[model samples]
Each structure stands twice: as structure tokens, then as C-alpha cells.
Target: MGGRGTRAVAAVSAAAAVLTGALAGCGPMDDIGLGQSGAADGGVGKGAALGVSPLKNPDGTGPGLAPITTSGDRAEARKLIDKVRTKGRGPKTGYSRDKFGYAWADSVDGVPWGRNGCDTRNDMLKRDGRKIEYREGSNCVVISMTIYDPYTGKTLDWTKQHAAKVQIDHLVPLSYSWQMGSSRWSESKRKQIANDPLNLLPVDGSTNASKGDAGPATWLPPQRSIRCSYAVRFAQVSLKYDLPVTTADKDAMLEQCT
Candidate 1:
């Protein structure tokens, strides 16, 4: 692994240790089934008590969205959110997933983990999963792992058979980005944002599905304590892409930190 990849793994390892300890203390919960794909937006549960704060993990190489608890950090989160430009969303007339390139393509450049010999999805899985077991004879294909879902504040032992339990979420949903000026962006730029680790999160699939195309104004992670961190991440992607969020969304982002 290269420096970025190493850093990503190291970051996740540290977070996984914390979550694993938490799980050990609480004991495993009953299998309540799993969702298909999604993040952030969901019902409340155990909080993601430990992980890299978005403020510290600006590159998105780190694991799990930790709660922004300090007032100073919240103020800083708000400052970043304030820098994001706000405007009305555009029409989604011509938008399709294809415009941003194929799902989990490793071909895109200018984003972390791109062209890193692993697809974006697996890169994410490796980044956020613990006790990961790769596919037979394959270093890049993850077959099993334990995922600490920051959105729902739960953890699960996941295998390839139940792959949908975890999802790689576009923090700024692709469709939401489309409406927020991504439609005017170059195809390559769109692909960069689409595959960018900074814009992605691995969380409960159903929670992620609940957040489809919705902005902070309408949807947020069920783990209330991490809302500020989530807002910071949303702003990070917006600023990086030069995409303006909606006025309502920006307001909501600011409110999360305050």
C-alpha cells in the first residue's frame, strides 16, 4: 500500500479498535436483518462514540464519523459550513448515474484511492471494516468483516453473503450533487467527486437509502451527536467541488454545529 492507502488503513484500524472494545463490553445484539444500501439518515441507536472527527480527517481516509463534542470544534465546523456557497438546486432532467462514470470505478484520478489497484467500494470496505478477510487468492476483494455503522451507531459481523448490510455512501448524494450544480461540472470532475473518499462513508445500507438525494436540511445521521461532524464533511465536499448547497441546506449545516 502507498502512503495514502497506509494512512487510510491505519486510521480505520484505530477506530476499529475503539468500536471493537465497545462491542465487547456491550455484547452482540440479535440479528435484526440488514438494509440494502445507505448512510447517516436513520433511527437513533448506540452512538459512534469513537472515530476520526471530520475536522481531523479532512481527506476522508479515516474511519467513522465521530461526534464533534467540543464547542471550539463545533464553531470551527460552523465556520467551514459557512464557507460553502448556497443557491437553489437545479433541474435533474439529464442526470443519471452514468454521467459520473461507472460505479466504484478505479480509473478516476484526483481522488484518494483512485487507481489504487482496488475498486472504490472495496477500498472503502477495507478502510472502514475490522477483522477483514479477503476473498480467496485476492488481496483486494473483501469477503468478510465487522463494520461499525456510524449512522445508526450499531456494529455487525458482515460477510459477502450479506454484503448489502454495509454501503459506501456518497455523503453528498450523487443526485443531490447533480441538482447542486454537478450537472454543469466536467465529466472527469463529476467522476472525481463520485469516487472521492472524502465524499464517501460506509454505513448501514437502509440508513443510507433513507438519505437518498436529500440534503442536511431534510436528512441527517440518526446519531445526533455526530451531526456536526457530518455537516463538516458535507461542507468539505461542497467546497472541494465548488458546488453550492441549497440555502436551506447551508442553514441546516450551520445549525448542526451550533
Candidate 2:
């Protein structure tokens, strides 16, 4: 991730007077159930006490990517990890952002947030962030919000003005997907994988960027506790897209759960 933030602040001076949420995961409205690896909007990974357990969110619909600390949850995470097939990665000869569709394209059909009017990026922001501050006259354009970031185990005060602070990460990167045989998929199928919520996470930008195109073998979240849950999420996306991971990546993923 670039050192610079990605969002363009519309009115910085005005926002100085606006209120931002101080504690993200403690409230009832922002979190409930197993949200994203357990990064549920306002709640997931609020830490060991506040986050959801991955065992409860098999579908990857929940928000945050919390750690699987319980023995049972870890075992379940391993079960999910075992489901992904192992194989060699293909070459990255003809990969590019355009290969999947414009970044966060809402028109991509057959994905959860597709055709939802809100683009996938904002949809994910709304999906995983809490105490959202939308721009005046626009609920879809989030100006700022508090996020419980599972990767670094820190609550982030983020604004669209500082987009890099909070990025919508592709849990299974697009280029990695290409190398894993997605290159052969039809454009629509590629689009589905690219925009799917199951494949996305809202995480600290630099941490997310540090994982550039790396699979589980080469990179995992810095937070050790969340590793098992991260692997489960990766496996979930792989299965959903009918994609495969490299043999080493699959092995490493399982090790996290073990």
C-alpha cells in the first residue's frame, strides 16, 4: 500500500467538528452474529472479548476476521481449510486490473453486491465499518467511519479522505487468482470473483498492501491469532469461486488452523 491515503477529502475543515465513534465494537447496533471472518462492521475483532467466532460464520457473510482461539473453533477452521484443493500456480503472463473489470464495478452480475447501486468498495465499507459518516445527500458515499481491523488488531478511525488507512482487500488477490487458473475463466466469472464480498475484507491499507499478490504460504495477517480465521476465509473464497490454491499455500493455510 502507498504511504499516502487513497480518499479525497471533500471538506476537511468541516469534518473537524463532526463526531467519530471512539469505541467501535462495544455497541449493539454495529455488531451482531458472525460478521466478516468475524470483522463484523462495528464489532468483529474488537478483540477477544467482542469479536465473533469464525465457526459460526461458515458462509463468510459476517464482517470482521477475528481469531479462532477456541479449540473447537480451530478444529472447525481446519475442517474448512482441508476442503481447498492443492495445485501449482499458473504463470502471470497476461494479468492486469482490467482482466477482472473496473475496480469495484457494481454492474458485475452474479455477486452479492453487484447491481446493488452502491459499488463494491462502498458496499464493503458499509458492510464492515461502523459509526458510518456518509456524505451529505449521499448514503452510499461514506466520508468516514470506525473500523475494527482484524489484520493489525487495532480499531481504525478512517475516512474516505484517508482511504489508504482503510482498504477493501481482496482476500484472494486477483492476480493470484489469475495464477491459480482464473485466467481461463469467462469475463463474467472473473467479475464475480472480483466483486464477491466473500473474497473481500476491510483492513489497514499498509498491512493489506504488504500482502501484495501473496498466498497463505508467503503471507498471512500479521496478527497471529487471526491466522486460522484468515485461512478459513481464503478457503471459503476459493471454494465459492471454484478456484484452487498452490500446494504450498494450501499447506500453510491448514497449518494455521492446526
Candidate 3:
């Protein structure tokens, strides 16, 4: 009887040891550092090693969000047309021809080329030219520049050799705007529009001349795939700046955007 009792006691002890070992293998039931399972005390987890927090939830519900709507609206465009009527008439030639043979007027809104040390050509060169190397000690002038032509999808090296190749295109062409509502704008406002980044795009000079102040109804970028995006951006800029769009222009934008 004594022998049998001792064996039973030994068996029970062995069972307890096995259960303790299993529990120890699981480490602890408490939260580990950086929520890593079986991690050493105070150790950061793999997420921290990757420069991210393991506790962060990525569901995109942070702040300043509004519901997105897919519906198209032309209200802003109409409002722009109305506002432009208040500004008074724009230039007569509508930036078609300058005395200098450039497509743009020699002066916009009485701000003459090289007047007050401001030249439209130089201004445009500074505005559109990329990788610009400035003339020494001249804050307002660029001696040489480079640009990527969105219209042609080509990078143009615009040194003095190809200075004329890079043209500043009006997003709302001057002629088109004149017909729509610019015919009534103050000279200052007209000048503002002429220099406005929203209205300017760098393009091949010849191509821009070919476009010749025409709206979407008549001309588009040479690249057909960009037409929709171009029309939409043009419409948005016009709407933002209170430029007018003719019925035909509106129809063309709608066709492209839709």
C-alpha cells in the first residue's frame, strides 16, 4: 500500500511540472511593450522598427473631411462670366499681336514691356522656365532656362538658341476671353489675368501661336489623352478667376469633361 501511494504522489508531481512548463512557454498574459507577444521587457516591436506605431488604426477618419460628390456643376463658370462683365473691356487685339511680333501685346494694361524695368517676355521666361540660370545679380531676369512642354510632352532646352521656342500660353486665351467678357475689364485686371499662373502654361511657342487665342471649342492640347484633364483644369481656373466661357466653349468643356 505504501509503495502504491508513493507512485501516485510522483505522478501528480510530474503532471504539475508539465502544466507549469506549458504556462511559462506562453510568457505572460499582460500587455507586452509595443504590444509584441513574448517581447523582452520595454522592447519595441517590429512596427516600431519599421518607423510606425503598431497601435495606429489606418481607417482614414482623422479630420477635415467632407463627403465627395461626383455630380458636375457649371454654376461657378456662369458666375465668372457675370463677374468679368463688371471688370470692363479687355484689350482690343486680345493679345493677338504685339508691335514686337510676339503673339502677346507689347504691354498689358498699360504696363509696357521694359517699363519700370519689367519686361513681359522676361517675366514669362522667369515664370515658365525651369532649371533657370539667372543673369548674374539680376533678381528679375533669366539668362537661360529649361522647361517640359506639357502640350508636346517634350523637354525643351530653352537657351538663347531656343528662347523663342518656350511660349507662355494663356489658359483662357486672350481673344476668347475678350469675346466672352474681357472686353470690359480694367487694364489692371487684364494685366493681372495675363500674368496669372492659373491662366499661364508653358508650351511650344509655335503650337501656342497655332492655338491663337482659341478656346476648347477650337483648340486642344496636341496630346488627345490629356484633353479631358486640360479642359477641366482650364474650366476650374476660369471659374476661380471669373473668366467667361462662350456657349461653344462650355459645350466643348462638357463634352471633354464628361
Candidate 4:
């Protein structure tokens, strides 16, 4: 990794350092700094640490988008979601994934895991999932893994055979981004957003397909319990790119944590 990828990693590291250990506590409130529940753990947990509270992993540098189960954490989630700007969606004309870059392209600049000889999809898989198995003699191609599907609140025994068993979701969907002024953005910026780890999640394939370019107003994770944190992740991606969701989408995002 170099350029933006390096900085993204560093920024995430800094943000995570203070809360990483605290996140291991029993409740969602402990994911952030809701209160002093107990003694701090030694350090960051492993990739097996799925269902990580989104409140503590603001940069999307951690694991699964865990549910905001506690009232305190839900309140914090709402606050984050509330900050996202709102606008009407724009035209989708001339929009295509290629405009951003190749699917999961590694060459995108200014994103975590970019230019690291691995595609964004596999990078996300390794980041949020565990029990990973890479292709023989190739570390970049993920052949299999067991992942927590936060959207459905289920664990999947995934393999490459049915690639759709798991998918890399763009928290801010590419088509949604196109409508939210990304259509006019430079190709580099588009590619950066497309590949940025902060905007990506390895999630349930069916749920991701169902979301298909829709914003929070029209779609949410199937596991209603995780909605607030999902909205927070959406807002984080939007704010990072200086993009705006539709007014309805913003409102719907607020509903999740309230």
C-alpha cells in the first residue's frame, strides 16, 4: 500500500487505538466510550472479531457492522447518522461501474488496501471475515472463508463455488454515489470511493443484491437490530466523500437508531 491507502490505514489505526480494546466488552455501549464497564483488554482482537460495533469503527476499518443493541449506543448511532447532508438524487445517465475503475481494482489511489496487490473485494473479506483460505501460491485471491452476515445476523460457510454466498457491499452503493454527484466526479475520485475500505463491507450476498443502488430510505439490512449502525456506516461514507443522501434517505437513516 502507498499514497492514500497508507494514510487511510494510519488514520484508522489512530482512530481505533483508543477504542479497539474497549470494543471487546459485552454490550454495544462498550463499543464506543459509553461508560467504564470494566477493565480494558490488552489489544486489538483478530479477524474472527466480527459483529464489531460500527460506533467504534468509524472508518469501517474493523469487522462486521454489528447491531446497536443498547439505548446508549443507539443514541450515539443516531447522532452520527444525523450529520449526513441531504439532497435529491440526480440523474444516473452515463453512469457505470467502469467509470470508477475495474471491479475491486487494486490500483485505485487514496484508499486502504489499494495498490497492495489485492483487489478491494478480497481485502474486505480478509478484513471483516475469518477462516480465510487463499488460492494456492496466490495470497490475493480468496478461495473461501466463514463470514458473519450482519445483514441477516447469520454465519455463512462460504466458498468461491457460489460467489454470491458472500459479496463486498459498497456501504455507499456505487449507483447511489453516481446519483449523488459522483457522476460528475473525476474518475480518480470515483475509483477511490469504489475501492476505499472505509466504504466497503463484506456482507450477505442476497442482502447486498436487494439493496442494489438504493439508499437508506428504500433499503436496510434484513436484521432490523443492526439498522442504526448500518445507517451510521452509510453516513460515514457519505461524509468522507462529501456526498449527500436524499432527504428521505437521511430521514430513514435517522429512524433506525431512534
Give the clash total for candidate 3: 8
**lDDT score at residue 5, model 4, on the 0-100 scale:** 98
Query: What is the descending lDDT order?
Result: 1, 2, 4, 3
Q: Taking the tens digit of each residue's C-alpha lDDT, what string does model 1 give over 118-192?
A: 999988877677666888898789888777887888987788898888888999999999998888889999999
Candidate 3's TM-score: 0.54
Worst 10 residues of 2 by lDDT: 41-50
Estimated TM-score for each candidate: 0.81, 0.81, 0.54, 0.80
lDDT of each: 0.81, 0.78, 0.52, 0.77
Candidate 2, residue 145: CA error in Å? 0.6
Model 4 / residue 37 / CA error / Å: 26
Query: lDDT (0-100) at residue 16 of candidate 4?
Result: 85
Best by lDDT: 1
Model 4 clash pairs are 4-110
Model 1 scores what on Cα lDDT?
Answer: 0.81
Candidate 3: segments with Cα more than 4 A from true spot: 1-124
lDDT of 3 at 120: 56
Better of 1 and 4 by lDDT: 1
lDDT of 1 at 164: 84
